[model samples]
Target chain A: MEPPDDAIPDRPARETLAHLRARIAPAEAASGPVLPLGAPPLDQRLPGGGLALGAPHEIAPEDVGDEAAALGFLLALLARRLAEGPGEALLVLAPGHPLPYGHGLLALGLDPGRLLFLEAGDDVEVFRALEAALQAGSLPAVAGLVAEGLPLVAGRRLQRAGAGTLLLILRPAGAGRPNGAATRWRIAAAPAARDGAANPRPRWRARLERCRNGRTGDWLMEWDGGAHRFDLPHGLAGRAPAAGGTPA
Target chain B: MPVALAAAGPGGLRLTAVDAGARALGLRPGEPLGRVRARVGSPLRILPAEPAADAAALERLCLWAQRYTPRVAPFGPGEDAFGLHLDVTGACHLHGGEAGLLDDLERRLAAGGIPARLALADTPGAAYALARFGAAARSHVPPGGTAAALAELPVAALRCDAATVIALKRLGLKRIGALARAPRAPLARRFGAALMMRLDQALGLRPEPLAPIPETARYGAARSFLDPVSRQETIVAVARALMGQIAPRLAAHGLGALALRLSLHRVDGAVKALDLGLASPGRCPDRVAGLLRLRLDRLGAALDAGFGFESIRLDVTAADRMPEAQGMLGAGPAEDGIADGTAALAEALGQRLGRPLLRLGGVASHLPERADRILPWRPGTGPAWSPAPLPPRPVLLLARSEPAEEVLALAPEGPPRRFRWRARLHRVAHAEGPERIAAEWWRADGPARDYYAVECEAGRRLWLYRSGPHAAERPAAWFVHGVFA
Candidate 1:
C-alpha cells in the first residue's frame, strides 16, 4: 500500500537507517561475546558492558619509554582471557622486541605454559603470523608487537580473521593510523598511589581514545599482579569517569 | 693437453689418475710425475688427487642410482676403483628390460656429464670383470653364460692384488680361462683360498651378496616433468599429489609424518630442498599442501627457480605412530577441531618462517637469564607454570644488559638516584633493597650481582644491577636489566 512520501523513506535514508542498525546491534550477535573488564565504571561506559570478543583492539603506549606499561596492560587482558577459557594464547613478538620474562609473566598471573611465543623477523612476518593465528580460531587470544601501525587493509583482514577470538595489536606511540578496531587504548605509566610501599602495584593512565558503538574516557587504572585484575585506586574510585562520557 | 692427478708418495709425486688424453700419451697411473714430465714433450696439467671427494661423489651416485634399482653398492673391499654395482634382478622389468634399463642409465649418466662403463651380468664379480675389461663400452651377458663371459678377460679382472696378478702371469695363467683349467689343489695352495674364491664367485659357484646403501627415508614419491616448471602453483599441485600418494602408505603402517623434506631437482643438478616440521604427527594431504603453499609464498625470489625444476621428490624424513581418533560419545567435534586447527596453524607459520613456535619455560637457575628458557612448543611436554614467592620481576628482559650512564647512587653500592639509559634521564623517587645474588661457583660466570628495583620520578620502573664491589682496577658498573610496568 502506498503511504505518505515521508513515511516511505528514500534510498539514502534507508541506507542510513541500515548503517545505524548495524552499529546498534548487540555485540554478542555482531561478534561473539563480551569480556567484562571487572571494573563497574569502565564496564558501564562500554556499549556491551565490556570488551567485545572476536574483534580487533589496538593498544599502544602514550610515550616511547612507556612501552613496558602498554605491554603490561596487554598481558593483564591476556591473562584474563586465558583464565576464562581452556585454550592457549599466542604472542607474536616482532623483531627488536624483548622477550617477556617468564617469572614476570608468572608474577602477573599469566601462566607461561599456556602461552606460545613466535618471534617474527619483521613487521610483515609479524602480521602474517597474527593473521594465521587469528584465522585458526584455536587460541582464545592472540597478540602481536608491531614496530609501527598497520595499514588499514591489513587491520581489516585481521579483524575479519579474528572471529570468535581476541586480537590485540600493540605498537609504539605516535604511529597511530586509521584502523578497523573495536577499541583503541593508550597507556602511560602513572605514579604509585603509596609513596613508600615495599612493593607497589603498577599504575597506568589508560585512556580509551576510540571505541566503536560506545563512549571514550580516560582513567587511572591499577593492575593487581597477585590477583591478575584491574582495580581503581582506593580513594580515586569515586572520582573516576562516569557512564556519561562523550560517545564516539 | 693431457691431465693427471698426482699425490706425494714415498719417493716423490706419482700420478694417481690419468685422463684419456694422458693415457693415449703412454702416461699411465702410478707413474712418477717427474719421469712423465721429463719424457712427455708437451704441456701437462697436474693437480692433487682428492680421494675423499671422489668417495663422497661415488656415494651420492649410489643414492642417485636408486631411481633405477634399490640395490646399488659402491665397488669396495678392493683398490680404489671408481665404480658402482647395481643388482637389478626384479627391478629391470619396471624399465622395460635389462637392455632398456642399461640404455636409460647410460643416457642419464651421459646427460650428467659422467663418463661411465656399463654392463649387466648374473653376478657382481662377472659384471665387474666384463665392464672393466670387456671390448665394448656396454656389454650384456646372457643367462647361464657367466663362465664363458669371464674366460677371455685378464687375470687382473678377478680384482686380485698386483702381486697375485704378477705371480699368475709368471705361472703362465695370464687368461681367466687358463687359471680355471689349472690344477685346483696346487693353485689354492699357492695363491691361498682367496684366489680360488674369486674365480668361483665370478663363475657363479659361490653366492656374493651386495650391501646397498641404506635408505634414509622409508617412504618417498618422485615425479619428473618433460618441461621444467617454474610456477609456484605447479609445484604446490605436484606436492599435493605426492602427499596423496604417501598418505595411504603412512596410514597403512599406522604412522604419521612428523617431518617432510621436499627436494626440487633443478635442470642443472642443483637440488633446492625445503623442510617442514609439524607440531604433531599428521598425514592430512590438504594440511601438507597448505603448508607447502605458505612456504613457497614466503620463499618467493629466494627459491631461485633458476632455469626451472625438472624433477620433484617428497620424502617422509621423520614419522611417528598416530593412534586412531576415538571421539567421546557426547563430546562435540568442535572441541577436537580446535586442537587440530592450532596444530595446522603452527605448521603453516613454522614452515613459512623457517622457525618453530616456542613456549617459555622455567629452569631451576638462580640467574634470571638462565632461569627462563624458550623451547619448541609441544603438547603436554613442559613443566607446569606456577607462581613462586619471589621478588618483583620485570615484564620485559633485555637480550643483554646495557650499561647505565651518569649513575649517581646515595650509598657506595646502593640503588642509583639518577641514571641515563638510551639517552633518557630518570630520577629515582623510591628504591628497594640490593638482592645479593652470587654467581654459580661451578660455572665461574662472573662477579656477583646486587639487583635493585628502582622507580623513577616519571613513574617508569627499571631493574638495575651492580656488577661487582668497588675495586681499584675495575669499578663497580651499573646496568639496566629489565623494565617493570
Candidate 2:
C-alpha cells in the first residue's frame, strides 16, 4: 500500500506559509529581510526575507558586569543597519538598568531621538508595552531585558502581530529557551586578541549558538575600545572552533 | 441752542449759559463773542469754557445709550461736538419700530436734560450729515435708504474741514449731488480718492464701519427686579437664566470656565461684582451657581430689582478644555479617587474659610528661600523646570523647615552626631558624607550652608545643615534645612 504515503518522514505538518500568505497580501509576504543586524551572512537566509522579522529573538545576556559592553555592541550593529535603510527606530525598554547609559548608545551612532527609553516600573508593564508596540505596528524593533520564562502563547501572539518587529530579548544564562521563540542567540565574552602591544584593551566576542534554520557555531570576534565595532577575529572565517568553551 | 453748565469758582454757584439768544442774533462757532454781546446785550450770562463739566456730560450720555446697545461709541474728545454712534441693527425692532425707537431715545435724552440730536441711517456719514445739517430742516431718510436721502446734502457732509469744503466749492462741487454725477476718473484725479470714498459711503455705494463701545463685564447672569429680591429662591431663578446663557455658549466653543464673575446690575446703575472660582473648569450651571451663591451671600444690599436688568452679558475670561491624548489604552486617574480627593479638599476649605485662605505651594528659582512659594488662588504661572544640576536633593520636600541646633565632630566635613530640634535632642546612628553645596554667591545676602544627610536612631532622616563657617569670625547657626522621608 506504498508504505502508507501519510507516513512520509519528510513532509511538513502543513503548508503554513502558503495558507498564511493567502491571508496576508502578497506585498507584505514578499518583503525583504528584517533590518539586518548589520552582521554579515545571518541576513542572507531570512524569508521575509532578512534577519529574524517581527518577534523577540532571545539573546542570552552577559552578567551585569558585561551589560554595557554587550548592549553597546548589539545597538551599534542594529543602528548601522537602520541607518543603511529608510530610517527605523529602536525602542529600548530598560525596566531596571541604569538608562542603558544614553551616552554609550549615542556614541554608537544611534540618533538619540530615535532611541526611546521607557522606564517601565516593573517587568510585566515593560513586556506589555513591548507587546502593544508590536501589535500596533508602531515599532520597528523592541529590545528588552527579560530574565524569566516567557509564556509560549504570549511569544507567538507577539510574533504574529506585524512583519518588521524584531524583539531582541536579552535574557540571562540558563533561563532556558524563550517558549515559542523562533530564533535564539547567545552573546558571551571571549578573551581579547593579542595586539602588537603587551597589554590590550579588554575585548569580548559573541556567538550565534543555536539559530533555528542555520548551523550553530561560535563566531570568534573582537571589540575595538574606540570606534566601537566588531570585526572577524584575525583569520577565522567559515571555520568553527575545534573545541567548545564553558556555557555562559 | 448750546446750553453750557459752568462752575464759576470754588465759592460760586453753578452758572448756566444760554446760547439761544446768540443763535437768534446770528452767531456761529468761529464768530467772536464781542459781536454776540453787541447783538444780544443783557440776560445772556457768558461763562468761560468749562471743559471738565462738558466732558462729564458726554460720558454720562455714552453710558446712558449703553442701555439701548452695548456698542455706543462717543465721537470727538474735549466735549466739542460730542456725538455717539449706536449700532441698533436688530435692536430697533425691540423698541417697537425704528421711528418709535428714535422718538423714545429723543424723549429719554430730553428727560435726562441732555441737548442732543440723533439721525438713524444706513451709513455713519449719512447719519452724521442728517444729524448736523439736515436735522429740524430736511426730511429724514428712511432706515437703510442712505443714497436717496444724502444725495442733496452739501459735500461738507463728508466730514471735511472748512479748508477742504472751501476747496471743493472752488472746484464747482457745491452740492454733494453734483459731485456724485461726475465721472469717477476726473473726480479721483482732481480731488483724490478720499473725497470720492466719503461720497460713496454717504451714497451707500461703500460701507462705513463704526467701533462699538465696550460691554460691561457680566461673566455670569442675573436679572434685576422692580422689587428687591432678598429671597434665595428668586436670586437662584435669575442665576439660572444666566446659566442658560452661559452653558450653551461654552459648549458651542468647547470650553469650560474655571472662574466666573457674576455682577448684579443694580437698579441704581451701580454694579456689585461677585467672583466665584472652582477647583477645576466646569460648565454645569447649577454647580457654578452653588459656587457663586457662596460669594453672593456676602453682598452689602439685598439684590434690588427696582426695574428689571436692561440686559445681561456673559464673558468667558478664563476657561480650559480637557485635552485628548493619542497613546495609552487604559482608563485615566479614577475620577472618584484622585479627582474627588482634590476637589473635596478644595471645596470644603473654600466654603468654610472663604476663597483666598487656601492655595497651592508654587516652586520658583533655586535661590534657597525663594525655591518654594505659596501663590494665592489666582491664575499664576511658574517658569519651566530646566534640567540643571542641583544639590543632592531630598526625596520629600518641606514647605518651611523647623528650627534646629546641631553639633558636629569635625568642623567642615562631618555629619552631625547630635541635633536639637524643637528643644528635643536626638542622636545620629548611620550618617552619609557631607554633600558640599555652596550658596549662589552672586546675591548680596547669601547663606553659606554645608549640608549633611543624617539618619537618627528614631529612624528619621533629616537634611540638617550648618550655615556659616564653623571657625568663621561670625557666629554659626544650624538650620534644619529639610526633612526626608
Candidate 3:
C-alpha cells in the first residue's frame, strides 16, 4: 500500500531547508539551559537528555532506597532542582504508601518556600492532581506512587496529559512484567566502595532497562557530594554501548 | 493605615480585635464584640481578620525562634494557641538551663515590642499551660512536676474554647486540677475525650507527640545575631558560616542538597525567609548565595531591613549518602552533576520568568498536544514521568491546537492534500495518513481519532485527525490539530 510514484514525497528542496531550519531552530532556541543528568552514561542515552528544564522524569520504585534512602534521593533531587534556578519547586503526591511527610521531604532539601505539597487521601485525587499539574504546567515535575499492575491505558492518558511534562510514576520494582512506559530505570544503594581507593566516591547501581528515546543500559554511578556530580563505573564504557541498538 | 503586628513571642500569632474608638468605649480583652458593638454604636471601627498577614508574621517569628533550636514549630495551626514548640531536649543546657531559655525568649520578645508570657515544662502541653497561665517567676515546671505546676491554671488554660469553658463552669469544674481528679468516665461522657486528652497531656499522663513537618530537603544551616544586621555582606557572611558547617556534613554523608533555605530574623520581631536551589547537588558556597539573591528580591517590601536582622539560619531538608567510589568525569561520562548546573540556572530563571512558564515537551501517544503535560523542575521522580509510545506522533507540535478546515481525501481514510488551519488554506505538498488511534473504552466518552501526518506548501507538517464516535455509534468527522516539524 505504498503511495503511487507521483505521490511519493519528492526529495525535499533546498527551500525546504529554510523550513527545516525554521522548525529545528526553535527547538534549539527554546533550549534556555539543560541540567546535566549528573551521570554521563545516563545522559548519552537521552534525547538532549540531562534534567530537562521545565520537564521532569520519574525515578522508578526500585530506584527508591530503603525508606530513608528513598527520602534522601527525593530530597536531593528536589534540592538540586530548586537550587538550579528560580520558579523551581518540588511537588509530592504520596498515595497508598505512608510517607512520613515531615521526616522525608523536609530532611531531604525541600524549602518551605519552593515546596508545594498535596496529600492525596486516595489514588483518584493523586491522579487528578497529576493531570492538573501537567495541564496547568504549574509545577515542573509531579511524582505519583501507584499500585503495581495498574492499567497501561490510564498510564498513557497521564502521559498524554503531561505531554512535554515529566510525570514520575513510582511503582514497585522487579514486579517483573511489562507495564507500558517510555523509559524505566532501577536503582539501588551500592555497597560502599572498598576503602583505600584514592578518594573513593559514593556510588549507586542504576540500570536503564527501558527508555522512550533509546536504550540506556545498566550503569554504576558514583555521586560526588562536594562537586555534586555522578560519574560512571571505571572502564565500563568499553563494555556498555552508549545508545539503544534500535528503539526496543 | 498602620498595621499593628502582634505575635505570642515564643509562641505563635494571636489576634485581638482593636478599634480606634472602641477601646475608649470600654471593650475589654475576652469581651464579646457583639456586646461591645451594641454599646459603642455603628461608629466603632471593625478590624478585618488577616490570616495571610498573620501567617507571614508567624513565619518571621519562627525564623527568630530558630536561634534557640532547629525544629521550631508554630503552635496555633496544628498545635496549641499562641505558643511554639522548641525541641530543646539536648539544647536547653547550652542556654544554661530551661529557665535561661525562657528568660532569654521573654527579653528578646520585649525588645522586639512584643510582650510575652514565659513557660518551660517537661512536655509541650505543660509548657503551653505554663506560658499562658504562669506568672513571671512561676514559669518553670521541673520534670515530674507537671501536675503540681498545672494545678492552679483555670480550665481555659486547657486550650478549650469559650463554649467548652462555659460547659465546664456550669458543671462546677472551674480548674484544670479539679478536672484531673474527677472521674474519667463522666469527663469523657460530658466533653468527649478531647477535654480529658488535654488534661492528660498537660499532666504528662498521656503521650502527646508533636507532628513533625517534612520539608523534602536536607542539610540546612542558620545564624542569629544578637542584633539585627541589614548589610547584604553580613547576611552572606552568616550564610557562609552556616554553609561551612553544612558542607562537611554533606561531604561526610556523600550527599548534596538541591535547595538551600536562608531565614532572616528582623529585630522588630518581623521574620523573613529566602530559599535558594541548585541545578545539581553540590557544596559550592558561591553558587548557593548566587541563587538566593533572586528569592531575596521577591521579598523586597516584606523583607524590610528594619533596624537589621537579628539572626539567619540555613537548612538542608534533602541529602544523599553516596558510597564513595569515583570514576572519570566528562561531558557525557559525568551526567549527574552536569544537568545540576542547568537545573540551578533554571531555578534562578524560574523565579524571574514566573515558574509556570518553564516547560519541557514530553512525548505523548495522543492527538491533542495540550493533553501532554508541562511540569516544574523540582517534583519527585515517580513511574511514568518519562515518555512512552502508544501510536502516531507529530514531529512538530503546535502550542495550541486549531480546527481542521477540510477533510477531502484520495481514499476514504487517507491523508488530505489540502486543509485550512486557523483560517489559512494550506496546500498539501506531501502526506501520510490513516494512523488509527481508538479511544479508551473504559474512559468517559473518549473520542477515537484517525490521525494524519501532512506536510503543507509552507513545508510545515501537521498531525491532523478525524474524531469518530465510539464504535457503538455511527462514524464521526474530522479536525486539524497538532503540527509536526
Which candidate leads in lDDT? 1
Candidate lDDT values, in order: 0.84, 0.55, 0.57
Q: How well does candidate 1 reproduce the true complex, by DockQ? A: 0.52
Superior by TM-score: candidate 1 or candidate 3: 1
Tens-digit per-residue lDDT, B68-183, candidate 2: 87677776422135688787888888888888788888888889776667788877777777777773632356866776676677878777666768987988888777878877
Give the residue spans of candidate 2 off by over 4 A.
A1-248, B1-57, B60-222, B226-228, B245-273, B278-284, B293-353, B356-368, B375-412, B472-475
- Candidate 3 chain B: worst-modelled 10 consecutive residues by lDDT: B382-391
Q: Which ten residues in a row have the lowest lDDT in candidate 1 chain B?
A: B331-340
Lowest lDDT 10-residue stretch of candidate 1 chain A: A238-247
| Shift in Å, residue B212, candidate 3 | 5.3
Name the runs in model 3 displaced over 4 angstroms. Answer: A1-248, B1-159, B162-227, B294-302, B322-392, B398-401, B405-420, B425-431, B440-447, B455-460, B469-475
Each candidate's clash count: 0, 10, 120
Candidate topping DockQ: 1
What are the per-residue Cα lDDT tens digits for candidate 3 across B109-168? 889986566677888888887777666633777888888888878888887767888999
DockQ of 2: 0.01
Model 1: colliding residue pairs? none
